[model samples]
Target: MPNNIKFVKESKSKFLTTKEYHGYGQILKISDDGIEKHIVVKPKDPVFGITIKFLETGHPQFSIPDVSIDETAIMLKNLEEAKTFCREFYERRDEFVQDAI
Candidate 1:
């Protein structure tokens, strides 16, 4: 188990909040109790283009380094399908940030 989770930064939106764990290179959405969801944009396996996982609070895999795809995960074939899933289910939006410009 990881002794600690080092977060580099966090971004909050109306729909969800994301935290980037240092050295992990993945964005996580944690609930008040524990991790709720996470997205792996560039998975090591080309077969699974983007992996979106919805984990229950206090799940054993929460603290593990291995990536387990069970019934709660949806492996999208490509970026476009992943975006569509987010738009429909998560209601994602493309917002322009002035500070980033």
Candidate 2:
């Protein structure tokens, strides 16, 4: 598991708060799911932050040595579909953040 995780100087993972393409930044807020761990991603911009419980497949094994959302956990079957959800959530960030405040 440790081998899969990227280490930054100050932050934890390399993807901790970085946007993949020419997009706004993002942060990975991690959560525990009993035996497994999950994550909720938050955008750096003033968009709505998202909390997600992973819908995962397969089982954990020590021989695997690493884990990741894209590889292990799944919210949507297609990558493009997942991005769509993020964009839509970001658009409504104001409402979500406001209510939380």
What's the lDDT for residue 4 in model 1?
A: 27
Residue-by-residue lDDT tens digits, candidate 2, 1-101: 01211222222343333212112233434333334344344433322222223312122111121335555433223333335445544554443333221
TM-score of 2: 0.27
**TM, every model:** 0.27, 0.27
Among residues 3 or more apart in sequence or in different chains, the pairs in candidate 1 whose N, CA or C atoms overlap within 3 Å are: none
Q: What lDDT score belongs to each candidate, Candidate 1 first?
A: 0.34, 0.32
Q: Name the TM-score of candidate 1.
A: 0.27
Task: Report the C-alpha displacement of residue 62, candidate 1, in angstroms.
Answer: 18
